[model samples]
Target: MEKEIKVSIACMTYNHESYIAETIESFLMQETDFNYEILIHDDASTDRTQEIIRQYEQKYPDIIKPIYQVENQFSQNIIVEYINHRRAKGKYIAFCEGDDYWTHPEKLQKQVEYMEAHPETSMCIHAAKRVEAKTKRKIADIRPFKESKVMTVEEVIEGGGDFFATNSMIYSREKLAIWPEFYFNGVVGDYPMVIFGALQGEFYYMDEDMSSYRVNSEGSWTQREFSTIAKKKKHYAEVARTLDEIDEYTDYRYSQAIQNAKKGHQFYLLLIQGKFKEIRQEEFLDLYNKMGIRYKLTSRMKHYFPGISRLLIGIKLNLIR
Candidate 1:
């Protein structure tokens, strides 16, 4: 008979041949009292990603269950989470994308134990490290609290999508099974999913860094969408629309926080388009006021001294990149 699965890890991948092995290795390194399974969906990778997965599947047939798609599902607008949710049998489902990896071996074990004991947490998230993909240099730490604490729905709404890394998230499969229509409607999955999950119960946060979130990794949404100004504008507009819908769906209970998050993207939208005057409008005044002196100065320079600012910005971007 098959062992009782306590957790199911949902990993989505596309053309991550170079990184998928490490991702799978991290999952296999987990030490847990209960059985767990890894569910990987490869979206028709042209690379050797599927070959590597096949090797692992043969070695650990029961634990590594993968869906090798003939065509790309994400391009067709299919949410991989919903597909994996139907196949997941464990009580809880955890997320870790192909390009990201868990840093702690006990990550799953510790989270499962905590959730089992508390019984009130709708989701479990831990601190994660954000690293530069090419150089593997540490950029910043992604942590909301100085130490671990249970977070509220209001906090999650105010925190937005980047509050926690996707790899550090785990939630009850039952709660995820009934995700609202708004969850599906969002341009991005993680933010809305967390908002709805927050509605279910309080979020339990573990302060330790247990995962690594790769920034600008190959085939990542960030690299694709933010590669061009047009794409970034389109992405932010969709996000703003989704937030508006979310506000309405929640009956405007979190309207202030939702608006704050929405206006932030609008600020970026105007800033990137060189519409500095528009950013000071009533809709974005609060967000504008919150900007640091450096940003304010940079905007002024970019607006009034476009030629000089463009040269300076080019040098700055080159240094960072």
Candidate 2:
């Protein structure tokens, strides 16, 4: 009889030749009691990423399944999540891109144990470390809490797209199979996935840091999508619009929270576009009040010293990503 697979790891790659081997190695190192499969989808990479994946597939045919695309489907607007997910044979689906890896050998085992015990959770996420992609330097730890707790839909919306690390998520396949309308419509995947999962059932968060998230890596979404001011504006606009749709979908049950979340995105939009005066509007006071003293000083100086404030604002915007 075939071994029962408990987890299916979904990895999508483009030009991740330098990092794909490490990603696959991390998955292979998982010390799980149950069987698991690695499903890697290479979107017709021009580099050696596909070659590396094929090597691993040949070495571990039973555990590593791959889809080698003839042409780039992502550019054609095909969702990678759905493609790999359709072939998944596990109870839970874990996400890790080719550019990222898990730090803990027992990451999957620990998460699977917790998920099995808590049938109420539709998704589970843990803490992760953010590393500078080029230097591979440790930047910071993305710990959502000091202790384990359940995350609510409201909190998930407020946290935005970068709320939790993408590599740290393991969600129920059943929950994801029934994708919400908003999930299909959103420009980004991670934020919508968490929102849909939270709506389906509670999201249990473990406080352990077991994954490494490479920020602004080449071919990563951040690098490709937000490289220009126009792209940044468009991305934020789509996010806020998606949040509005979710509000209506939920019959305005979470309208207040959703509106606040949209405003937060708008705040960054205004800040980045150098509309410092508009940021002082009454509607944005809640976000403006929470700004640091130095930022507040800069905002004030924009009135007297427009040139210096504009230069400072440019520097600040670069760090936003």
Candidate 3:
């Protein structure tokens, strides 16, 4: 007889051969009272990713269920999430992508215990370390670092996509099933997903850090999209459109916050392309006025003295390194 699954881990991968092994091992290490399953959706990886996946699937046929795609569904604009959602059988859903891995053996067990006790929590999450894959150096912590144990939806939204790391979240499947159409429409993945999950109720947070978020790694969306100047411009523009649609769908509840995020991207686009004059335009009026004195000075230099603006901005960017 099949053990009734308590959680379905939603993981997606494409050409992550270098990192998939560690990801699979981490999932296999999860310890819990109720049975849990890892659902891996592989989108036509040209590397040895499928070979490694098959080996694990063969050994743990009941736990590691994977879908091997012939062609890339993401390229075709298919939300791979909806596909996994249909296949997931658990009462709860957790996430750990192919490139990221959990660090604790009891990660799942602790979260399951908490959710079973708290009837009102929509999700469970913990602090995560953002590790630069190449350098193996820990960068700045993923912020909106909460002093409170329970995170309200408003608090999560105020974090501006910095609150919950995808690899660190476990959500109630019942709440997820009732998600609105806007969740499916956003091109930005985790931002909208986290927002929708937070809407279900308060989220339970564990101060224990249990996972690593690999940033700017090869085959990561961050690295691939920012590989060229054109891609960064196009990517930010697409994000603006996607988030704008979500802002409309949410009835302006989070309108100002989302608009501010979009404004930051627009400024980055202008700054990178050397379009300094537009930084002073009316579209950015509200965001510009809200900035600190330093940023306000930068904008003034961008408009009045473009040459000085580039050098100063370049120096600031270097200092950030």
Against the reference, the lDDT scores of all candidates come to: 0.88, 0.89, 0.80
* Model 1: ten consecutive residues of lowest lDDT: 260-269
lDDT of 1 by residue, 61-151 (tens): 9899999999999888888778888899999999999999999999998999899998888899999999877676678999999999999
lDDT of 2 by residue, 1-321 (tens): 899999999999999988999999999999988999999999999999999999999999999999999999878878888898899999999999999999999999999999899987899999999997866677788887889999878988888877799999999998767777887788898988888888888898899999999987878878888888799889988988888889888888888878878888888878866787888899898788899998777756875688997897679757764
Task: Please count the clashing residue pairs in each candidate, in the order shown.
Answer: 0, 0, 0
Candidate with more favorable, higher TM-score: 2 or 3: 2
Candidate 1 wrongly placed segments (more than 4 Å): 273-286, 293-321
- How many Å off is the CA of 187 in candidate 1? 1.6
Clashing pairs in 1: none
Worst 10 residues of 3 by lDDT: 139-148
Query: Each candidate's TM vs. the true structure?
Result: 0.89, 0.90, 0.81
